[model samples]
Target: MSSTHNQEKLKELLTQYYLNTNEKMVFLNKKGQVIALNEAAEEVFSEDNDYSQMTHAICRRCEGYSNEFDLMSCENCFLEALEVGNGSFQVFMRTKDDKIEPFTASYEVIDKTKEIYAFTLHNVSPQIERQDRRYQRLMMQKTISAQENERKRISRELHDGIVQELINVDVELRLLKYQQDKDELIDNSKRIEGLMSRLIDDVRNLSVELRPSSLDDLGLDAAFRSYFKQFEKNYGMHIVYHTDFSSQRFDSEIETVIYRVVQEAMFNALKYAQVDTVYISLYQGEASIIAEVSDQGIGFKLGDKAKGTGLGLFGMNERAELVNGSVNIDSQVGRGTIVTLEVPITDKR
Candidate 1:
């Protein structure tokens, strides 16, 4: 074949590919006027029937969000930013059938002489929904695992700590019954009393660890203050605690979720961070209650293998989601770690 004929055939092949591709492709001028569009784009904005009539500023079919802002909004409109050469962005747009959807979009200058640009969009709503569903399932599994583990822990505490102590006390009492000397009998009685006291304290501590009654009786602030004091004494770590809610109360579920997440974060810091001091802040935002636990200690890489079971972080996320909340963990090696939990609160009192 002649070179001229081969060139013509190649042009025809390119035209066919452009017209048949599923991706929505459009060519626009510097003025944001639609210069031309492929068959996929034609179907998306079929209301116009004529491509020449479609301009980005007035297109109704593309109503959605770009750069976390409504696409129609004048501020940070991705189309407008094309004149200044911006990067690819995620966009959610209403389809021709009126269903809102997500798309990954890219725009680039195609003809500098004419100030023309090519805009491409790839539909990603299905992939996003699938990922979200998978995440929710994983979270549910983690939550169930955490509950089971906690039950096992409480069972162990009752069986090993309290029950064993009671058995020892029983043996001591049996020895007291056989004692002949009054002084020895008195010493045995004192030993049994001390054992009983220690057992009582252990049971109380176990109960608190399972679920602190103060959480339900006095609200989150009181529970946190009491817990922090005990934590400091146990770990010899100094905690700087601050809170804005004096006596303000929230839905029980929200309060519990926030308190538990913060508590878990604090424990993680103490176990891993090697820091002597930690900071905890609790406050109410406009629509959410926020708890932040931070430490200026040795932090680990965010995605590296965990030193511990790693369920603490997962449980925090699961609990936060139960209350329509979120947990964010930020850490860098040798810098620090900050765990923040934000839960939406509907103030009941």
Candidate 2:
């Protein structure tokens, strides 16, 4: 059969199947115009019988979106599929009754010659709920994994660089106390003393990983600069940093969340992007603070399973949401990865 014929047959079959649905069903045109809906769908998206007035009401209520950016509707809007003429997706939606529900939706071009398209949403509340639970569990695991990785990194840095250097310094100082050929050995001892002092400073700097005093004492800008310096020094990755936030101290939780997210994103960039350079931008808007990290290197597939624990992205997202913020990652194979996080901020008054 012709593709056109097949589509019509499929639509009819879908309509018949959907008529028996206990959940909501909605159909939209390419312009987000509500064309058809089952009884459940009508009641969910509209309060009255005038379904035409509903338009993309359901799309507007979708919960998943890139908080880092301003979006008119959920990123999962069926119109996104309509744009391409053959994409389908599902997402959580908040109904007109203020109840959250899930729907399985698809959009396809019905008549390419006439530019007519159809978007269908089948009530998939059960499936969506199940998937959401799975997502949460995955996120929790990610957070735990990230914490462990951090501990290991700090431990190694201290053991290899700081602790070992201190040991050598201690031995040198002991020799200085024992062997003094008076004026002859004084300069050599002084030079060793200078090296030991610098080593002490380095160890002190390494301790910043445990808890950056700069975050509380100097605020985010200073803290980030210090952290980025250490990131470059230790990981050998260069970061292009930019900031435009008002020099105001945030709640401790917000500060820590932002710091950790940036830290994670940079690490991911270094590991996956294979690029030597990372870009970071921080700016505050009227109601939200935004952080963006981008890297130009070998990009991996989005939604693809991460080779390791896959907790890095998950942890970053959880931290963002902890502060009522949202995280978005945009990446494509061979293009690069961009992570943007936004958190709501209130005036201290």
Candidate 3:
């Protein structure tokens, strides 16, 4: 075959490959004229794409752009860097529908003398959205942890210091009642005793909410028993708590994370599941300590718009990760949701 015929055939083959590929591709001249566009690019940019106006139109609709980044079209503008043959990185672009979409784009300068550039647009919107959500979850988890730590500090102060002072005052009032003959003093002493009793209960409840003393004092088994009993009473949700973790002492952090994750999962069940029963189980399985919180409530669609801030599941996952654990949630529309967390047990002994 002649050299010119071979070149033409090679061009046809390359054209067929690109047209068949799923990604969108477009070629533009230095003066910003649309020289060629593949089928997908034609659909996205539209058949009647006004090259003159749409050339820089993308800059106006893109997100996370700043003048400091020199991002008029894309951050690096790979088409402009074709001379160096370095592919520019992830860039956000605007669709014809005015929606900002993410793309992993690259450009190759075909002819330096002619200034012709061929660009490829790989749709990465789904991946970018997933990454952004993961970041948001991490931030929310840190915020929740900080808030809980603050509450714990305050609860400890109230339980150890302020409540003790109140108790002392009540004791003094009783002593005064015994020393005085006035009926008014005796009545005041009774009122003070009642107030002190209520205050003590509040203190204990606050402390438990912050850091369950039972978990610290007794361990996960006893702590869970008290927690579930109270959960059933408060939420009217019957939780069938089962455990084969007899006398198992988990690392303090591991125990706390597991307990809190189960607690949140239960709360999610009550708030969204709408069922009356949640089954919880914990035991040593293989090299990990596994905790499962399953509820027979109305389930939810994963990755759908959450009823609330959507942080419940996110928080649970974060807590599990803190102890080298993993959380899995399974649910459908009518079926109940099951949240499972598995933490690798360390052989510290």
Candidate 4:
């Protein structure tokens, strides 16, 4: 066929494909004015009865600009970048249903002599929602795993520590009954008394580990002070602590959740940060309580694969959520890490 006839045939084929495709497509001029749109684009604007009168209308459906520029401004728009052949980027736009949704957009100069550009959009909201659901399910599983591990630890402590001590005392008492000399019997009785004292200490330690009695009796402030002191003594790590809500009290559930999250954050720093000193601060907001723990030690990337099982961070988040709270973690690879927990003072139950 002749060159003119071949060009006409190619245009017809392109027009047929554009009309039959499901994706939204439109043509615009260099000044960002709409020239023409395909049937899929027409249906989207039809929901608002805007298709017939949309000639040369500036596309205001953009929800926000990309992160590289002002979030909601039109400056440096993708259309402007078409002069340099910038082809594709992601954007959020307001749909006919009045919802701001994400779309993968592609822009290209279809007519170089006239400076006309073609823009195509593909909806991506369903894929984003599916990923969020998967993350939430994984977090729930991690929380359950952490609880089970804690239960096993407590059980092992009782069986191996206290129960074995009791057996030793029983044997010592039986030996006392078989002693012939009075002096020998007295020595055996003294040894039994020593074992009983050690057994009592073990029980108290276990009770504190499960749930400190001071937390219920004195409140969060007093409990934290005592816990921090013990932590320093045990691990030889110093914690610079400060608090403004010294005598204030909150709902029991809120107090417990905050305490547990802070405890876990501190443990994570001790195990991974490898720092000698840490800082902790607590204060009350208008309707919430905020606690922060930070350490100047080795940190890790936000989305990088974790070195450990990572259940500690998951457990901290789960505990906070139990009381209508949130946990925020910030870290840099060579800098440090900070964990903040905020819980509303309202009744969560």
Top-TM-score structure, candidate number: 1
Tens digit of lDDT per residue, candidate 4, span 173-201?
A: 98888999999899889999999999998
For each predicted model, how many residue pairs clash, with residues at least 3 apart or on different chains?
0, 0, 0, 0
Looking at candidate 3, what is the lDDT of residue 74?
Answer: 53
User: By lDDT, who's the top model here?
Assistant: 1
- lDDT scores for all predictions? 0.82, 0.74, 0.76, 0.81
What's the CA error at residue 147 for candidate 2, in Å? 3.1
Off by over 4 Å in 2: 1-142, 184-188
TM-score ranking, high to low: 1, 4, 2, 3
Displacement of the residue 94 alpha carbon in candidate 1, Å: 0.6
> What is the alpha-carbon lDDT for the whole of candidate 1?
0.82
Question: Residue 26 CA error for candidate 2 (Å)?
Answer: 13
Ten consecutive residues with minimal summed lDDT in candidate 2?
65-74
Q: What lDDT, from 0 to 1, does candidate 2 have? A: 0.74
